[model samples]
Target: MTMHIDAGPRSSIALTGTEFAELDRLIFEDDDWWAMPSAEQAALRHRFITAAVAHHLEHNAAYRTFAESSGFTLADLGAPGSLVRVPQFPTRMFKRVEVRSVRAADCDVFKSSGTSGTQSMVWRDEPSLERLAGSLRPEGDIWRTLYGDVDLDDDGQMVHLGPNRREADGVWISYIMTLVEMFAATRSYVADGVLRLRDVVRDLEGALADGKFVCVAGPPVFMAELLRHMSDNGVKLSAGDRMAVITGGGWKKNESTKLDPDRLRSLAMDTFGLASAQQVRDVFNQVELNTAFIECEHHRKHVPPWVEVIVRDPRDLSPVPAGQVGLMSYLDPTARSYPCFLLAEDFGSAETDNCPCGRGGTTVHIDRRMRTSSHHGCALRLAETVRTD
Candidate 1:
């Protein structure tokens, strides 16, 4: 595999984790996750109001019916936060309408994974992808700081473990890889890694042996297989090499639906080797976006106020009081080229409540609804995190 190292740092405005934590505190303090001082964020909200009104008037038959019955016009939402009063377009809209603010050529892109013939969710990541992509850079510095700088032979290699070969809307992994490319040569799952799981580990062992050690990311099922393959091959990564096993998506049915970290590690211990797997951390992300909320050692998908989250009733679309599990949505005013505020079918709860993290924000708890079935998969969108850029 071949790659171009991104030098020491990508930008002058780069922030280490601590600096980002401070910035996150400053910018994200109260109810300002999507409320940035930038004119760009405000403009995007205005554009959304206009587009939503137009949709209500023209294409959105369901919205038009709702508006006509309620005496709400397409122009009713000219003010920000007005959409909150109206019933959200049902999560089923994706299966029925091309519910986009702009044309494919005009707006940013996101895609959805096809459930087992039941639901169609938008997995669009193109919008706000740059914001999410930039978020990962600060994390790179976190790695450099937490684990002292590791010397690489320059042309390092990696084995990525997810649905990245084709663009099927796995946005979180896409940004994760983009962040990783800054440090090493990335060997793709489709292009270079083996079609057979064991063979992939053999290739990784070979890369590490050749002094081109790499990083890896994937779902627990696939990653476990590869880790086992590595164990069978008697492989071990060096100190300079890094790997983070991400619990980015929903659980695999007919398998374990539990989220116990110890059980997850125990299942893959013999294969990936627990010591090596310890480096495999969890990154939280949303398939619909570019900015990812990462996980700390506590397994929490931490968020700053820049990425706004809204938990509402799936039946009528009202923001549920904190601590109640509801359908999760996001408002990313930072994304300029596409729709900034997006309502998704993600299931989680919000907490205005305090946290032990020394930050003032909410911690999301995933309820595994999307993976349940098409009907329930349309229930809520659980935001996943970083790796794709």
Candidate 2:
């Protein structure tokens, strides 16, 4: 079967059928691809990113104009350092314009959760959606590494703290959370804009009694609220090492209810009777990017070999030294429906050192979102065109 489904304008610069199949095999089929040598991984990333950029430049008119204005040509992507020269649209651009390499009618649009009446709409075609589904499946090597000896398919149950998939159709985080249902039996606790805390407690208690492994996942804020509710009612379950708490989406804009990572993990451990901190792992992703960065046992969010992450100075968009906090940017080759190279409105740092968990690639550390007034560089310039165009 052809892995790529392109329903938009065809381009000669795009990856050919054979090339796409090879790339897909390396990423989704080859088990040892993540453990490859750093040099080899970099070479693969360079090749894939070059093709992806070329494809987008030919198919996306807005992106092409932006690249031309920035004086970034195909020649600029020759060196490893040249990856930074690729023109990047600010993630906010998605809110202002429909940035797509595929036909609007041929893609599913996912919207980010926002209260400001402006939400980012990300387009994902069939191939792009398939890549995402493959990345999040629990049978992958990364998932096995994080969840040793815990089988979710046979003896596990998922207790999600968000709405079901149908209720969260276009909402990105909730929709992603529900995707785990495909692997394990799942029950959602939030419905009709209310968290059914009693239902969650009852199911968790039942799982504890039955001795079945449980994977509880949702936004950190919702998880925190559940933890607090259990603590207040003195309802504790002895799930010791039989349960895992997976939190994602952060405590987005919930400043008053925010709990730092350490505090959140501590609460989960104490409330759920988990034996170690390793059972509480966090996941990181955004609507624009197709890949999800999952935390290993050592608490580092491992960046896969298929993507490149850079921390850039917010003022001038130059690359920052490793471990220095700045605006987070990404070169995501998996997103073929759009130019996934983005200058995001997030503040974070990244390091390429070998992690204690035996992962050899880069590990990203996200700090917080950049203030709206702090937007700069290509993002700011792109916003100017939003008014003129």
Candidate 3:
């Protein structure tokens, strides 16, 4: 089903696997290599915002009120600065406010685990929600293609950490379940002896014995627990060439744990008998949208033009120079059902300089915006996840 329902208000606004293609082309395209041509890309970004404004005016109660007051209209809004003149409800308000796109019979919701030391609500239309669901397929299929075939059991054997399933019962429940299904599929490989980890290496060893690739992905703190276990057990996995350990969810704060990308890579290579960071890529993404950009070993994330990642000064929302670390603000021109102009809490700088890898365009060097803390002594920076008036 494109949409997954929960008992009540917690149901998800997710799309289906079959619908990912349409959404993919809408927001992201394979041709979006490097940065987008400024003029063309900006035009698309303008269209996305125009669509959201029109949608809000038509269906969203909160936006309708604001639009009416601001004299919002369907004119060619033509410019980025002009688009911002339109109101933006900081995403955080969803968790506390009653704002919605009309009192519909159906709405999708996905609530974060509050793991980021914050609580928030992520909403999406059915089609966008389906695209979010389809994202997992590409994410999983990429791993599967790299490692060979994997297996999974329908039974909930592998534990899903952070929050309970009931927690996924948010308005965007489909996105949450898509996350659940992804976990199930990934863990199935382990259950079927396809991948190994500190908690279930032996089960995954069966896959290794058969020459299949294995993958481990989760928050850093969660995986660190297993890495310590694997280290003590004298099980060195020189498997980086064939195995992958992708850690995301930023650094788990509110807890005194630390996992640096370099250190994490070192441990994976040492314990798992891996090779280089190239085999393990860190992904940058969010719950609101379906785009997932992978970072190169150099820690630079190459973004296509469809995705406009702007590094803004933390003190002021003005743009910052390239190569300088600052707050990450995004504009995804293709996003529908939701506003594409995203003011996120993620901290990182645009990679304005040329890369030895020959890939060019703007990219993010770091994103401490979502991070509560880090081991590196870089001056602390925080962007309001959502600053609602």
Candidate 4:
């Protein structure tokens, strides 16, 4: 495959279209239940990650420097051994550094909301973004296996408490992707710097009044405020209606309000009239990682086979035993712009044993993020604004 290499800051190292198509086929294989055996999946992932590492080492200068500094060689990655040798960079590094394997002109620069301080720039080539879009091919099948046809139900309404994609910068892509996949009528309460609380309440109450299912989604802080308002205003919803409230990101802005998961679940049941606690689908995701660790009915966050999770000692970043919470790090081969190995700021425990849900993958439990990490971002700023009003 022919490629253009530049000598300047925009030095490029990206997979060709053909290479990306092949890699994507392996990474995003359509398996609804992800029922592949642990041993087979591990073997496949090992090969994929090794190839991914080699690709980055050859193409990405920043990743090569980081790997060499960490005492990793391409030869070392060639062996069939523990993946622990691969170096994982901190998530905060993205905020301060610009690392990519592709030229700036060839990428779509996605910026964070800058809720805390400065916005982070994450570059993605068209191929990576297209792969990301294709990765969800199994999502519909997985949702069907878990929540049944409810995800495909066209009668439901999608209510987003955050800003629309156009107004949210690039940080709201995940939210917008979810909204689009719902394939139902949708509305955003906060968009273009406007907070239509009354309009949201009217739509929500009207939907419930007509015996229609409503899917409420957004940041926990915003959802908490909506639920609190619904409860205080005595807006009753039908328990018989199919309702689900999915919350993501952290509760940093609502930390002062003490947003308890149990309390929120109770509020969802009491005010929004959700039928089960499982309907409150909390997820563990970050701007750095594309895959989301969605909580199942048992509240266990299952790590898909495409990536591996490691809990490391916070002091020295050494791998800790199962059940011991520490730094949450991931090795994802699907990421192409930069090194897929990432050390997140959060602390979480990992269980490799099979879950009761019959899915045999790494199950993670994130305790919380390290307090020392940076907090400036668009979501935090939006949360602060929403909370103040």
Candidate 5:
């Protein structure tokens, strides 16, 4: 499904299905290399985000009212300066407002379990979900090619370190759960808030016994727990240069535990028997946005080509320089169902400086969730409940 862009005589811009398809194709089907033509990439993001802003202005009345009140309209988004002027709703507003571009009947509802036990509702129609899926498609197939393992197909092993899909509570968390489920031949959720070290290590042992490549993914805190257990029990396992631990959900749950990432990596290398630090990947994303910022070889979370990330001053919500730490907001053209340009509660730095990975996109360095916000959602709760010891 494509967006219905009304380009009347007075309309700022009208993009056809062909335009969307080309953008989708460019984003999904392209090869993953470091060299992205800077000029061409910028032009593509500007065109796509501008058209998306116009689409939201046309279809979402609440968004339109908010945009106009904030002194923005479809007419105001062509130039770079005006484009940044696109109004952003707070990410938490998704909880109280049902401001969707699609009709209620056409949308599928998803919920985010807040840290305080309240759930926030997110509505997405099929088309928007398709766009989200498209953004995620590229990373799903990486493991097969990681170790030159042609035999690794749907039958590959996936050891999940967090809640399973049945227990997943947010869009991004569920997205990762589904991706791991789809690509891995066999799957296991290591901990159900109760770390069963023996069972977890046994599954790892089975996956590696036959010289198979295994894709292990979950919140870093849980992975840390597993690493601690494996270290204590003297059970070091190996996949012979064919295993990877993809960590997500950050170290929020272990803030009290003081779980160090460097130590976690050290334990992972010894416990999982990964070839090198490159075999361990870190992912950055939140439920409010459609894209997942995967770490490159340099460990930079490069923003995908189709999305725009801006670092803003927390007090005034204005743009900051590349290196300065501030609130991280996103302008995502992929979501036609709701306002995708959202000011997140995350604190981070967005840099355009040359990365050793050679990828041409903003590299985001997330510091932590905003201390003032009460919306500590699913992953944090999962982390807090885990019985690490």
Candidate 6:
């Protein structure tokens, strides 16, 4: 295997295409990933994370300096419980600066939804983008396994509640949603920033009339809007066991319109005539991270083996006990264009016990996003300590 090193102030030790391919197979293609033993999974993740850290140390000058200041070294990673010492960038930092380990010219920039009036900007090279897509492959596999009866082929249709890829260019959520198009035929109901309720009803009604398996997917807000429209118009589809509703993103955009997960599921069951609560599933992702944690049939979000999630006490950034709500942090090894080890501003807990769904490993529960006032002080402190430029 040949190795190439770039020479510059922002120099990087680039992984070869063959190396990336091997990593992708190990991380994303393994069929028995969720069933792997914890020790074996940890050892595998530690190896990849160590290499990822080394790559970022050579590529991202600011992150290297922060690591050095924190007395973190590659040797330190050899000790037990050393992974938590890995310096983490606050997720909000991406909103304030461009954090990339690869050349800007080689990256495609993506922005967050910016519901808070400020959007995070992330750069992804082709390799990182490929990994992002690969992370979703397990989701499709799990969905197929759970809903084996559903014929999710070219014959089935996916009714996307968001804009098409081109219409939502550079928007991360839309990009992730449109990826489902590759699995089956998809049609978007939103056009020019407006949700076409009539179009959505027509497509869904047509699908039910033909007994075709259909998936309605997008953010929960749009799903809620569709449900309300259907309820107000007294339109209900009896597509029991033939339709699925997949929701992602946030449940609450604001206080007045907060939609509980159970509420959303119930409304979906009534509005679309879904067979069970299992038909209404949710997916989790963020602009700063490359991996996606998808809920299984049991409604538990299973964390993939390639990444490690730590719930940290918001005050001291120390790891909290499992099943305790705190700030969520991740050590994701999928992104070659950037360091994805990040301290997110979301409140969540992790569970390591076996799930009823039979996927044995860690599962995460995303409670809610930390309020701005709650996280701003911590974010500012972290920013002052880590120099990004």
Which regions in candidate 1 have their CA more than 4 angstroms from the true location?
Answer: 1-87, 107-109, 115-127, 138-157, 163-183, 191-194, 206-213, 231-242, 254-261, 266-278, 313-318, 334-346, 352-360, 370-372, 375-389
Ranking by lDDT: 2, 6, 5, 4, 3, 1
Tens digits of per-residue lDDT for model 5, 182-286: 555645453455656677788888867866678788877678778878878888876657787788765664357555666777778877777787778777766
Kindly give the stretch of ten consecutive residues in candidate 4 with the minimal lDDT sum: 1-10
Count clashing pairs, candidate 2.
0
**lDDT of candidate 6 over 176-197, digit per residue (tens):** 8877786578998767657788
lDDT of 2 by residue, 1-389 (tens): 11233334653233565556667887677764468877777778888888888888888877888899988899988887678888888988877777778777768889775534456778888788878766776766766754577667778889998879887767777777887786578998767667788889999999878878888987777787789889888988788888888987755443664468999998888889899999998888888888888888889998877788989999999999999999999998888788899999889999886688776788999988866743222221222222110
- Report the alpha-carbon TM-score of model 6 versus the true structure: 0.89
lDDT of 1 by residue, 1-389 (tens): 21111111211212223433433443333332423333444344444444434432443343455557877665566677565544444444544444433233444434344444433333232423444555655334323332235553364555655434354243333434445554456555533223355546676657656655355655554555565556666765543324334444444333344345556655554444334444555555544444566554455565544555678887887788877988877654343333334566567886643445344455676654544344422001211221211
List of clashing residue pairs for candidate 6: none
User: Which residue pairs show collisions in model 4?
Assistant: 13-101, 113-378, 114-377, 114-378, 115-377, 115-378, 116-376, 116-377, 117-376
Q: Tell me the number of clashing residue pairs for each predicted model.
A: 35, 0, 34, 9, 3, 0
Instruction: Estimate candidate 2's alpha-carbon lDDT, on a 0 to 1 scale.
Output: 0.77
lDDT of 3 by residue, 219-253 (tens): 45545656776777777665646566665555534
| Candidate that beats the other on TM-score, 2 or 4, i.e. the better one | 2
Query: What lDDT score goes with residue 112 in model 5?
Result: 60
Instruction: Write down the worst ten-residue block by lDDT for model 6.
Output: 380-389
Candidate 6 residue 283 C-alpha distance from true site, Å: 0.3
The models' CA-based lDDT, in order, is 0.47, 0.77, 0.50, 0.67, 0.69, 0.77
Residues 1-389, candidate 4: write the lDDT tens digits: 21233324444545555444656765466554357777766776677677777777776777887888988886676555478778888877777777677677777766656544445566677665655555444254444433456543556677887777676667743343354343467777785565566677888878877666677777777777787677677776774447777777675543565567778878887776666787777765666775666677776777767677888998988899988989999987776776668998787799876578777767898777677645634455557655323
